[model samples]
Target: MSFYHTPKALSAFDAKFEAQKIAFGPISFQVAHCLLKFEVLATIDQAGEQGLSIAQLAQTNVLNEYALGVLLDMGLSMGLVWLNGDAYVLDKTGYFLLHDDMAAINLNFVQDVCYQGLFQLDKALVAGKPSGLAVFGDWQTIYPALKDLPAEAKASWFAFDHYYSDHAFPQILPLVFAHSPKHLVDIGGNTGKWALSCCEFNPEVEVTLMDFPGQLAVAKDNATKHGFAERIHTFATDLLDESRPFVEGADTYWMSQFLDCFSQEQILSILQRTAQAMTPNSQLFIVETFWDRQPSAASAYCVNATSLYFTAMANGNSRMYHSKDLIKLLHQAGLYVDEDTDNLGLGHTLLRCKRKP
Candidate 1:
């Protein structure tokens, strides 16, 4: 006999499918802004026993309460806040979102930067160029606009720097330091976050961070704050320019989250230049995300979304390049892969290679 569903079972399945379809529609900005605005308010709420009134919240320096009430109403609907008559209070989600001590506090970076950048995703894909560059002229424009902002705003961006380092260092550093390298170079190192982490992990390692002038200034300050001023040095350089400096005799080179920012040809040129700077025994460690041997649905979805966002905002693209692809690139640059590690948490992978001896 044929296996056919009963009419009642088929109706129930169809109903569930329709419900899911409705639930999965695009997330509205009204809803998104509610979550973000709640974070700022929740932070204020925790500072004192009594939460600020709506009028007080509106006039607060961190945020304008009148503009924020629109969001607060939405938050109430989302169960992120509780309304005791006219008094508004934070709920469980609000407290967790406002917790600054957690590494995940960096979620605001996504809401503030990525969300706005991705708003023009459809136009970006059709034009086949970065909307951010086209809209704002260059990557540097965004920095100056944000440079003078409050510390909270600055911290949002810095949190991303911290997040990247926290996820990448643990897996890659142990293997690199095992060789007892004396000096290392971090190309395009932003704010020296990764370099500081490296120095913290291996006290013997001295680091040279190379980046743009503005980024170097920030990195210098960060290095000082982290007590790595003497050990970590900053220099302004363009990795893409022919005049780029490669500190000769360095034992290791780190290119974390750098390669994906360029085209294939550009990456090849960068790798070649880096190889020329390395001694025969020198090593290179690359920390990035790539597809798993068998990727799950969630992983694939994340990769696709990130690739699209990067392309739109920065004219950059991320791919899950296999070990063979990396080896081929290294070989073209006259280097060889010595070790490889995958699934380094936070969707990162590490490739350790050495200059051809």
Candidate 2:
């Protein structure tokens, strides 16, 4: 509904180049992967100031000079390499490919967990289910399937999840504790990371970690290992099951990057159940990366693309929501936003809510 304006407009020539980039995105990605896998890019990086000609590269790596030259030509257009005379040198993008944390995380996530499965995006969109999930295993959603994924795939999935959520914890802890709540519920407390954090931050606070049974076992182990076992209670239940009520003794209910895993109807249903458990004094906190609220178009692009992961791999029913859409759902579920704070971490917002008057 909103038109976002960008600072730079592509000239007609640049626009055509952009179109070509989009047309060959998959090929470009695979080339990048091959470059990394074969260490051709790394070798170039090591060559440093002098760079490497195709002759030198071929002789060193035991690759065909012409074939390496063709790939490097592609890299030239991709900004991954530059032609210095007859030699090729690594560019800024090429350097990041080898050393950047964010780049590595994203590349692994896409290649390991998402690449092959994304072919079913159109089918998932039309059927309204994660058809692409079959590539991993036949399951209702990726949550239940996480325990069974290949080790590398699981590593990528958790790494992607943690990279975004973990950094926000330090800044968010102060905000959540400002109300001085004695007991908190960590909804979707995957691996008890946040629960452990809460227990460490406050001596008086007790946390109930709520999650599916498989995840609860991991959380419990993490809590026990960290010496927070007694203070961190585990509640294992399916949040999607309406008959199973949430445990009631909580001054604050926290759902961090959780609600966006379900559809609007499911989110409303979960909120309605959460509402029933809240006392008048209880507060609900929601943390999410709303695409519309991002500071930059690039950040917005990342957030929006995550919706595709939900469509093709995660659940097929949920997405990275717009702030307006989430607020509307909150209003419908009889919760009103009492405080709205943004820019929590990379790109997240915290919504502190109370039962509607």
TM-score (C-alpha) between model 2 and the true structure: 0.95
Error of 2 at 291 (Å): 0.4
Q: Model 1: C-alpha RMSD to truth?
A: 7.3
Q: Model 1: per-residue lDDT, tens digit, 43-153?
A: 545645455556766664455766567667766655556776566677766565556444244456555456566667787667656674444345532434446544654
List the candidate 1 regions with Cα displacement exceeding 4 Å.
1-25, 32-36, 39-107, 126-128, 133-155, 293-296, 316-327
- Where does candidate 1 have its weakest 10-residue lDDT segment? 1-10
Candidate 2, 55-116: lDDT as tens digits: 89998785698778778899998899998888899999989988887778888898888988
Q: What clash count goes with each model?
A: 2, 0
Worst 10 residues of 2 by lDDT: 1-10
For candidate 2, what is the total of clashing residue pairs?
0
lDDT of 1 at 344: 71
